[model samples]
Target: MTTVTSADGTEIAYDSAGIGPALVLVDGAMCYRAAGPMRPLAALLTSAFTVLTYDRRGRGESGDTQPYAAEREVEDLQAVMRAAGGRAALYAMSSGGALALATAAADPGVTGLVLYEPPFLGGDKEYTARLGELLAAGRRGDAVELFMTTVGVPAPVIAGMRGGPGWSTLEAIAPTLAYDDTLLGDGRVPGELPVSVPMLVVSGTASPAAMQQAAQATAAAFPTAEHRSLAGQTHDVQPDALAPIMIDFLLG
Candidate 1:
């Protein structure tokens, strides 16, 4: 594991493997370097590029300070890019995709970007309203539940997931959910995040239409971006299914 201190003095932890251009993976809410869906993705990416996956501040082995802001998260990515020898390809999922897009707009060192299913609602209002209420009320579990429910997962599935591996992992890092919600802004307006680098916006066929539309919106916003659909895949698309698409996009 390697470490770099962000401008705010928070120590960020990252691991690097493989050889070639550096690729930094930014995980979504409740995910760290060791938890959530990125773990398997990291292993697969290591075979192609020098993969750098880090624990976001306040999660895993990373250090955190009081009074968090989205800017600090952007700086964390900048710190990792610096640790990667100044430039890197970035792959961000969910709200992490939003963060990476925001960072790329400001940081020239991000040479390329790949975003998968950033959870913004282009047409849904009620869903986001419920999520905002849960977040404002400090109902972390309910916030997650609302998100999952809005994404079209059946109520039974959502209930079952509460104690499952994914839910357990999320529960452990619940503090970041509020941060994710903040970035999403109640899923009403897509923030102006621009990218000059070659970019790909990927979405799953099984995901909600709003999510797919958000991915489309992101692709439209980028000067040089393309959209790809992973047929029959959901938000939980496994790393194995995703690795080849990412490799082709990044290496092509």
Candidate 2:
């Protein structure tokens, strides 16, 4: 593990493997460097590119300086890039994809991006307000459960998960769920993204129709963007299935 100081002086912890061009992985909601699908995917991509997976602020080993803002998270990513020799390619999943896209648009030096199913298409205003209310009231478990339901998790499945092994981790980071909600911000992709930087938006074929549409919309929004659908894949896409596609976009 390694650490870098963000512009705000927060310590961001990360693990890097392999050699060659730097590729940083940004995880989505409820995930950090050590706790998400990125670990397995990073293990596979390490052969072709130096891959860095880090804990976003307020998660895992990373430190959070008070009062959150979405832009601060972008600076957190910039901090990782400086740690990786000043620039790096980014591959982000779920709401992390939204952050990566926003970063790539704002930071021209980011090089490229692989954004997989950002979940940035539709969200109700009133429900979102309720989510914020829940989080601010410190109803972390309810907040987490609300997010799960908002994302279409079946009630029974959510119930099952609550009693299972991963539930605890999910609850622990419940407060950060609001962070993701802020990034989503009404769930609509902007009409335009800064030109010149290359981007690839990917969605799994088996994911909801809206997910694939969001990926396509993302590609359409960027002047230099491509879209792909992984066959037989879902939001929880397997590492073996996703690593090669990311390699093609990030390394090729």
Candidate 3:
């Protein structure tokens, strides 16, 4: 495992693999470098581009400091880009997508970006209120459950899924739940991304309309971007399926 120090002196851990132009994969909630949805995608991406997968601060092998700001997470990406020789193609999912967009907007080192299903609500008041309650109560588990529910997962099925082994794994990293909420920011207009970098905004066919709308909004903000829907795919899309789309976008 290779490592780099962020501006705040946090040691960010990352694993580098494959051979080609650098491509960094940022995992969403409940994901670290080795675990979560990005792991399989990293393996597939390794066959094409040099892939850098890392744990966000406060998760996996990375270090965390007091007062977590979205900017710090952006700096983490910058650190990895520096380690990759100062530039990289980036792919981020869900809340991680929001971070990647924000980072690409701020850091020119991000040459390309691919975002999948960021859960940004346009003007959902009740949904935002419930998210606020979950965050305020410090109910990380409930927050995730609420997110899935709000996205239209049936209550019983969501409950059943949460009771499975996979749910435990997701729950283990639940601390980052608030970070997603922080990025969503009361379900208003997502912050202006307006990145000139080449980008691909992808969403699953089975994902919530709100999420699809968010992807469209994101694509619209970029001067150069395309929106694609993965037919018959869901929010938890297989990495193998996603890797190719990501590679195509980054390599385009």
Candidate 4:
């Protein structure tokens, strides 16, 4: 993996591969280069794109700076963009959709966007506040549990997850959850996103009804956006189902 220095001098770790146009994969909450869906997705798309997958700051091999803000993250992606020949399309997963869209809104170098289930399901200040409380109290496991419960994870599953080996990693990155929340700002898709690039907002028909609605609302916010619902897919979208959709839209 190579590294790029963000505006704040934070070192971001990333991997770039393949041979065609550049495409950056942005992970949602609790995901990074080693722990998310991006790797397989990158592998599938590399045949058609020079896919760039990175550890968002504070996760994987990346460095984190103090007083984390969404703008800092935007700069982090821009730093990766510099490595991608100064321009690339973005495929943002879950909360990453907000960060990617914000990046495109700020940098005209972003040529296109493919957002999958951005979780624009409105904001809950109380949830955010409680999450902050749990993390501040140093109850990392509790923080992780709270997030899982909030996201509709069943109690029994979260109980099982607590005893898993990967639970430690989730606890370690619990603080970054707040960073993801910050990018979501009150959580309703922002009005008039100043992004004019061709965009596709996608959701899974198998996802919850609210999530599909959020996907629709997100598409409506972009001037040049199309909405697609993948049959029988859930929030954890299948790479095989998604890769072709991305290749077509990105290369079309």
Cα displacement (angstroms), candidate 4, residue 196, comes to 0.4
**What do the candidate models score in CA lDDT, each in turn?**
0.82, 0.86, 0.80, 0.95
TM-score of 4: 0.99
Name the lDDT value of residue 151 in candidate 4: 95
TM-score of model 2 vs. true structure: 0.95
Show how many residue pairs clash in every candidate, following the order shown. Answer: 0, 0, 0, 0
Q: How big is the positional error of residue 43 in model 4, measured in Å on the Cα after superposition?
A: 0.8
Per-residue lDDT of 124 in model 3: 59
Model 2, CA-based lDDT: 0.86
Residue 36 local lDDT, model 1: 74
lDDT of 1 by residue, 79-126 (tens): 999999989999998888878888888899998999998876644567
lDDT of 3 by residue, 25-123 (tens): 988776797677887888888878999999898888888875878888889889999999998989988878778877888888889988888766654
Worst 10 residues of 2 by lDDT: 190-199
Which 10 successive residues of model 4 have the least lDDT summed?
Answer: 186-195
User: Which prediction has the highest TM-score against the true structure?
Assistant: 4
What's the true lDDT of residue 162 in model 2?
84
TM-score of 3: 0.85
Question: Which ranking of candidates, highest lDDT first?
Answer: 4, 2, 1, 3
Backbone clashes in candidate 4 total 0
